[model samples]
Target: MASDQSTNPPIMEAKTRHPLHQIADTPTHKLLLKQWLKEEELILSRVSHKESQIDSVRREITQLYIFFFLFHSISLLLLFHASSSSSPSSASASSACKRSWIPSLCALLSSLGIIWAVRYKSEVESHLEKLLEREKEDAKLLRKCVEELKKKGIEFDLLKEVDALRRAKSLRVESKPVRKWSARDFVTLFFFSVSCLVLAMIRLILCD
Candidate 1:
């Protein structure tokens, strides 16, 4: 009887063992896993790209703030000097004001800079929000895929893998290095400095 039982497995044993045994090694499961892995890679790549874009936008915003501060400082200094009671300085400042449009030009540039910075910041924030939403959706889909695989009796620990990926992404974000100022930053600074110097020279000439 025992030999017969061994030769012909019982119905319960057959049912239980058929679906669970070697399910992960089957062709269908292998194909599913392959497709899932590809999707995982694509999502990871997109997340990385979005993070880089966010960093770039942040740097641009920082530059805008620096520019705003610089312009404000110059405006304040000009105002103070122009308002001085000293005869020579006041006379010079008055002459410069009459001959050149430096104050108005600076004000206009400052206003434009502020407007552009606010607009750009809003746009970048919106884009970042969309990317974050997409990331959440991708993570949800990955979890669902993992659940489906689990139901199919594929015993691999894919949920753990997904969680690990998420943790790694968080770590990367948390540890993001400060970016060095780029050539564009230097160029912008140089241009602003040169413009200010020219304006100063014109004012001095008018004063004389």
Candidate 2:
């Protein structure tokens, strides 16, 4: 039963999105289309900006972790080598060398910072998803309105402009996939924090 549950996790229900009303038969169809097109433009703009933010935050966090990992790995090696070559008399001093607290404190702070950033990343992603879903819902209504306008032999200038804007080189969504955070991501972060803290403690152990 447990294995089945794990293999077939229940799918989450889609959240309700704010809907755009279709009023294609009305005399004010043009006005409604114009308002909706403007709203669609705003949604796309925000999605683009938020996606960029998520990318930036991810890169900066990855680079910071790499920096700390290298610094501590080298420190551990040098400290170990120094302890091996030192005489018994200086053992006490060498052991005292292990009491270094700066790197450990910094590691703790970095771990905290990364955790916080990961949370921020999650929030941004959730917001982006909501925007995309809302856009999809609105698209359905917009298309219905367009079809009605077309059948009536009415041409909408705003609709044409919006379609052009959507096809614009700058505004269009790229082909690249948006990366999702997974269990592996969380594990990697946990391991990084633990490994750094352990190494710093090893330096302290060397002193004793």
Compose the digit string of candidate 2's lDDT tens values, residues 27-85: 56646566756765775676577567657756765765676567566766776676667
Range of the 10 consecutive residues with the lowest summed lDDT in candidate 2: 11-20
Local accuracy of candidate 1 as per-residue lDDT tens digits, 5-42: 77676655644664335455476666656677688778
Q: How many clashes in each candidate?
A: 0, 1
- Pairs that clash in candidate 1: none
What TM-score should be assigned to candidate 2?
0.50
What are the runs in model 2 whose C-alpha is more than 4 Å off? Answer: 1-27, 81-94, 97-110, 113-185, 200-208
Q: Highest TM-score: which candidate? A: 1
* Residue 61, candidate 2: C-alpha displacement in angstroms: 3.2
* CA-only RMSD, every prediction: 10.4, 19.2
Candidate lDDT scores, in order, read 0.63, 0.58
After superposing candidate 1 on the true structure, give the runs of residues whose Cα lies further than 4 Å from its correct spot. Answer: 1-21, 82-101, 154-208
